[model samples]
Target chain A: MLTAILSGDTPRSRILTVLLLAVLVCLAAAPFLFPGVRALETAATICIFIVLVASYDLLLGYTGIVSFAHTMFFGLGAYGVALASTHLGRSWGALLVGTASGAVAAAVLALLIGLFSLRVRAIFFAMITLAVASAVAVLVSQLFEITGGEDGLTYQIPRALTPAFRFGELFGVNLNGRIINYYLVFAASLVLFLLLLRIVNSPFGRVLQAIRENDFRAEAIGYRVVWYRTAATCLSAAVAALAGSLYAIWLRYVGPDTTLSFEIMLDILLMVVIGGMGTMYGAVLGAVIFVLAQNYLQSLMGVAAGAAEGLPVLPLLLDPNRWLMWLGILFILSVYFFPTGIVGRLRSGR
Target chain B: MSPGGANSPRPRPQGGVRLAARPDAGAAGHDPPTEAALTTTLLATDGLTVRFGGHVAVDAVTCAFRAGELTAIVGPNGAGKTTYFNLISGQIAASAGRVSLMGEDITRLSVAERCRRGLGRAFQLTNLFPDLTVLENVRLVIQARERKGFGLLSTAASHSGITTAAEAVLDRVRLADRAGSKVSELSHGNQRKLEVAMLIALDPRVYMFDEPTAGMSVDEAPVVLDLIAELKHDSDRTILLVEHKMDVIRTLADRIIVLHNGALAADGPPAEVMASDVVQEAYMGKALEDV
Candidate 1:
């Protein structure tokens, strides 16, 4: 059954399988297991980022396309939800309309970009995507009336999905709509992640990998390289948009800093590389490790700094404010040691 | 056997620039065969030309390949032999002309579209997916040929039919044992063998091999040649080979088309073309007495 769910693309290594299971279980029971408001927020962020990073993998790892417009798609979805919920009066139907429109808009934009730019060299494509993405970002910040500009939008979700509506207690934990919302994000993320797994293990996925390895040969082998690439771009954009919708729903707010920030884009890239490029399971590991480090690494650093107080330079270096530096060093070490990312290293049994 | 009759008009260089200024250059061995065989031309180029800046790499060189015959295209370095193959296979667009396959003009078609219309091309350089296993390299071609390349939900592993077909091709190429190994890890000879195996899996009506055995060991060369010979037995498949070795061509090609300075220097039976003075002078760079 597990094999069928994974599309028979097994994790390969025992350690990797265990790690994946642990991540799955932890995310599945994040509210009960972690049991803190901040912990739950971090868990939700990890879930959304997993979907985002995996969608990027579909482009970068599977199709060998480097796209910087992923966060733009993510922002589109958030804006879609924010606008619909505000104008149409915070209903499930409004959320549905927003999510659908966001995904469709993202797909259309991706198609246009792909048709215009995919025929060029890889570096040119990358540059075009970067240019398009930054333009979209500037447009969002300039459009104050509709997109809420830099301030962004704060809107209400359905009453059943908020913390105010309490049902009962279960296993000494409060049974409120907040936990229900967490499960909603978790369920959607799991389904989307599994669908992505199915995609990568399908014949279409194999063709994408073939293109990644050698686009010229893929073209000669009777596969329309441009067509396949465009299709992948559209699909990846739609999925990223969907992840954005879930993120908006979970946070009950949407903003440029939260969704459209270039920092988040770089974070997604780091997660994908840290996890592994081609392996779908890498997204899970990459998002979990990166998010945990982003959220808790500072506290961990503070604890280390306190312990190393007597040491001369060690405490200053281990200071919580230097967490970004520590993160950079971790990234370098991971790249230097694992090379293929954590999942790749584990699967190779090295 | 040569298909067209002596009365059939020959291909003339379109532009004013005469590449090989011999009057009898394109008119070799136009004798009508005694027995009229109803041969269908599978692939044909009409005034196919490509120019780089001012230099015409492939001059207005027109040629037709019919079913069941293996035609070897031989030329010296930079004779536009591979460039012609590229033009026909849709790798390089022609500066002026049309390419037709099975009676349909495919000049404007993309490489994949041409391949879908029964045009298969194997490169001189090994072009297998380096990251994928040997079986996977062949399997992708089979998947693309079977039109399952776009299947999203159906797992590739669920299709036992594709796996079986891919394994069969690998078995034919004698790389079945190395199927589990990555293409990058394979020996150079095995990589070449896998290239042929992928073409076989494609199973196009027209097979274009650009130096199929250019860098193979002696023992490895025979396997690919024998495979090509087997493919030639199929009367519906037309084979075009670009080779430099004289011995390989002598043993395999039914007809030889010699290209010099990107023009048709000689086109006829291998024996006739090999013995021609033009071929002797231009290709060999020496007279019969010089050797």
Candidate 2:
């Protein structure tokens, strides 16, 4: 069953398998294990980001396509959910409608961008995506009446998925709609991740990898390079948008700062790289580690600073406010040590 | 056979019925009238040309390659041999011209479309998926040929037929043992052989080879040459080879088309083209002097 789920492309390393299992277990039991609102929120974010980063990997790692407009797709999903819920009222049907429309819209936009830019050089495609992404960001911010502008949209979901709806108590913990919602996100993310795994191990995925390796040779061998690339871009965009819908559902809010910010795009890139490029398991690890660090690293640094209060420069260096600097240093060290990202390093037995 | 204009009209036989009448027409120049009557043109270029800015790379060149023949395109450096191949293969768009396959115009087709239309090209430089294993490199070609490359959610391993076919191709090329090894790890000669293996897997009606034996050791060259020779046995497949070595051309090519400075300099059998004064002055002057 595991082989079928993974499409027979296993982690191929003992450590990677263990690490992946640990992530899966932690995510599966995030509510009971973490036992805090903050931890639950972080867990949900990790779940959504895992899907987002993995979709990006389908483009960047597997297809050798670099796209900066991923956050735009994510934002589109969030907006889709937000706008539908805002206008259509708080219902499951509204959420479904929003998610589907968002995905379709993102796919259409991606197809247009891909057809126009993918025929050019890779660098040109990158530049065009960057430009298109920033343009969409600006447009979203400018469309005040419909998009809620910079303030964004804070809309309600179905009452069953809200924190107010409580069924009972389990293990002295309140079994509320919030926990149910977390599981909903978890299930969707898992299914999406597994589907992505199946895709990367499919014949289509092999052709994408062949294109990544050598587009010229792939074309010569009778694969339509442009069509395959455009298809990949569309698929990646739709998945990213789906992740965005889940994010909006979790937060009960959708804003440019939360979903569409360039920072989120950069974070997705970092996660994909830090975990591993081509391996789907890398997305799980990358999202978990990066999200955990983003959430808890500051507190960890504060504790270290407290412990080193007597030390002069050590305390200053370990200050909680300098967490960004510490993250930068950690990124540099990881890149130096785990050049192929953490999953690649583990799988290679390095 | 006449050695002049490649575009000259010939009394083409209607179909398979006339070919059986003259079974001994295999030897070129033996029976010119019978050979012309029996030949079927598989690929033709009509005033095919390409220009790079101010330079006409492949000038107005018209050539027709018949089925059951291996034509070697020889030329001096920068004589547009590779450029002409590129134009036909749809790698480089022709500034103006028409390329036809099996009597159907395919000048505006994409590279993949052209390949799907039975135009298989092997690059002068080793163009391959270096990261993939040798078996995988050929498997992709076979998968593409089978139109199974678009199978999403269907695991590649599920297609046992593709693997079996790929293995058969590797066995033919003698790279069966190296099937699991990456293409990058293969020796240069083995890589070239893998290139031919991929082309064979493509199973195109027209085989376009651009220096298939370039940059190989003495022993490695013949493995590919032998494969090309083996491919020549198929009368249905039309083969066009761009080569620099005179001896290799003399041994393999049934007809020779010489290009000098982006123009057709001579077109004939190997002996006649080799002894032609125009070819000698344009391409083989230095080589003949060395001899």
Candidate 3:
């Protein structure tokens, strides 16, 4: 509000301001430090993940509704765009239509899911979302007639910016030229991120948080609790769908595996939980950590596997995939060290 | 007994629970005293009834919450005090009668609809956004009010007007010092006060406060009561307070209404209502039994 913008240092806002600044600066510095544009691209992808985490925070953080099927919304956007553009013989116009349909699909799913679960307790809702996610994964995999099953779908997308990298001259673009996609995704993520930030700070956002903390009390004061939750879900779903669409565009491919994966759901849940539920910037923090860990773990696996095959000494090296053994350890540590996740850290003025 | 740290005060009065309304500095330029004063019928429930599956919680009770005055509904435990509040607030469906607000049929109105029509409420329980600052909670309601009045988003300068309005309400509630404090950080007493502040802060035409003083000490009780009186005496907004403390009711309310067994036991001036035979039997039996 006006007071928030005008006045200095209300406890939560102060923390938020600092965290936001740190996230932006770190992201800006990514390319310079990594010595390649690819590094910056990776950072942008992380920013997209932040969008996902932030949307989940709206549902899980502010509204206190943990949705296991939110990834389905994301996957819907990803695969929906692929099928629409490639099969329907379309272009950027199709991309626009695909985004709208993706959001609509998410809203419809939320409505049907919310109809039964909103009245039920929180844990029950979580269980139902989990059920939907699990079922959707199976359904997408079996529907070869529509989805092309495991083969997935990939189609060329027209890009005005592509020619800039076509010569492999500007910043030495090559087959590994994911840098442009990173910038594009980053720009989209930033726009959505800022909009979501305003929303959480808006009156509507406060009401959603109030509902999160306690619904019975909110209802007594004439807040239509159900409506607020449903609306929040819709907005959050649309954001997730956006991220999914961007993900497909970045990879230039989409498949049943992309839309149906529980891994994506777990990753999103982990991102928000690690970052902080109620805070928007926490999502960004969570995303950075998640993406970094994934890369680091994958690299470690590649090193260990390659080194194990031919090491000068101590040839007792194991496969890098063994790093999976440490994933549980890392998750436990993050949850333990930061009970409130990253949001709690920011709240403490970190 | 008050489950909260808000210790029981006056054994919970019987009948109507009224809350104070927001004060306007006469921006309307229409003098309430010179006018017919809204006919004291902002809300009316006709043969309104509610039943909880097997039991009739509120039975065929016809009552009206009027404009321009504070009317307190006080009753003992299980007297359908909350059931009645729920009926009016549209938290639950009315089994039978019609509820009309501002002469418009509002019986089937959703809670949000009632809010849109300048109706705000304070709960017997704290309904604050605990993580939000005291100022922010009021501001959200202000925004909610503005959205209802001016289609979601007005201009920036007009939005600043809402901030000013929120600031004034905080000052009125004596919570200006704690504007930056989260609801969770506030004491139990302050939370009760904040609940009272929120009820009046939105500048609603009608307010229903259920047991506004359930947790306050006798000293704190008077502060809330005086605020109620101040809000009602403004002559613009109407208030309905449910209180167990007769002293608060006697100090603040223009008229006192008593509900017993989900029916009107007494409705009149404080002294007259206090002397009713049914009210005496249902309410004062223990407090003044020996006398």
Candidate 4:
């Protein structure tokens, strides 16, 4: 089974198999061990990003397509749920409607884009997506009544997920709304991740890899390259929207800044590359490492600053609040040293 | 002056069964006789022209590549042999003309569309998924045909049919042992062989090979030529070969179409075309020296 993880049955794949199992175990134990609301929230956020980054990997890594409109789809999903909760009455049925709306919108938009714009060369497609995404972001911000404009949308979440709805306690952790929501997010993320894993290992995934390696050759062999790529785009968009829906439900908020911003898109790209581009496990590893670093590095630096406050030797660089500064350093170092991201490097054993 | 003027022998219809024959068949005045008798022109081009800005790469090449025959397109450098192949296979768009496969106008179809309709091609510059293993290279092609190449739920390696078909093609190409090796790890000759393996996996009706033995060693060239020869006799497949080697051409080509400066210079049986003054003057001197 581990041999099926990557294309080759090498020692690296065995290591990867062990590593993946360990990561899964750690993720399963995270909420129980930490118990803090902040830690649980962070873990939930990581779960969301894992889906988002893995979906993006379907495009960039598997299909060798680069589109900047991924976050737009993600935003649409969040907005779908957010608007449903605000206007359709805060019910479980409304949440379902919201998630479905997001998925359908992403699929339709992705189909149109894939059919029309995929005819152009790769770099041009990226540019067109970038332009479209920016326009959508602006439009969402401008539609104040519908989308809440710059203030974004916030509404009462369904009562089932509120703190008052306590079922019981499990393993000393109170089985309340927050815990239920966390478990819900965890379960959904797990199922979606496995679905994506199945997709990447499927015959469809092999064709995608073939196209990624040499699209022209793939076309000559009788595989409709355009249709395959379009299918991939739609699939990735749908999954990204699912991630977005999860995000909206977790926070009970949907805003352009959180869900639709270009920063999130960049962050996804960073995660995919840092994790490993083509390897699905890379997405998992990258999300965990990146989310941890982005979320905790500031606090870790804060602790360091408190300890070394009087030391003049490390003054300006060790600022705890300057998170991006340290992240930039880590990103550059990873790219320089690992080059192929952590998974790629480890697989190659270089 | 006409494209068909090179071959004026109009092959007479043996049974007079012209049910689906086009009404304006002889409208061009100088129709090649070969088409008159054997109406099974599996693939053909009508004044297929391609222009690269100021330069005309392929200038109005009109010819029929019939079924169950091996026709070789030989020429000097820049004679549009590869360019002509590119146009027929839908690699590049024609400047002005039509490409028909099995009497269906396929000029607007993409490369994959053409392949699906049984037109297989092997490139001169070996093109394979470099990162994938040799078995994987063939498996992808096999998988493309069998699974409609969009099976999202099932694992690729789990399909016993796909693996069997891939292994069968690899065995035919004699690369069964190197099935686990990456395409980059294979020698150039083996890579070309792998391309043929993919072509065989497609089981295409009409085969178009563009310099299939381009970079092979002397020892390796004959094996490929022999494979082409074997394919020719084994199946009633229409083969369009573009080769520079005179020896391989002599051994395999049933008929020869010599291209000179984006136009058909000579087209006939190999012996007659080889003995012709036009082919001797333009292409034979350089091509024969190597043989």
Ranking by lDDT: 1, 2, 4, 3
TM-score of 2: 0.92
How large is the interface RMSD of each prediction? Answer: 0.6, 0.7, 5.0, 2.2
Model 3 gets an lDDT of 0.71
* Reference interface contacts recovered per candidate: 0.95, 0.88, 0.21, 0.87
The order of the candidates by DockQ, greatest first, is 1, 2, 4, 3
Question: In candidate 2, which residue pairs get closer than 3 Å at backbone N, Cα or C atoms, i.e. clash?
Answer: none
Q: In model 1, which regions exceed 4 Å deviation?
A: B1-39, B286-291
TM-score of 3: 0.82
lDDT per residue (tens digit) for residues B191-253 in model 4:
989988888888888989989888888886776777788888744579999988788888899
Place model 4 in a CAPRI quality band: medium
The CA lDDT at B170 in model 4 is 88
Model 2 lDDT, full chain set: 0.87
Q: After superposition, how far is residue A244 of candidate 2 from its true place, in Å?
A: 0.3
- Per-prediction count of colliding residue pairs? 0, 0, 24, 2
| Model 3 lDDT tens row, A137-191 | 7777788878777778877665633324443433433432355556677788888
Which model is ahead, 1 or 2, in terms of lDDT?
1
Best by DockQ: 1
Candidate 1 per-residue lDDT, tens place, A101-176, comes to 9999999999999999999999999899999999999888899998888998999989999999899987778989
Better of 1 and 3 by TM-score: 1
- lDDT score, candidate 4: 0.84
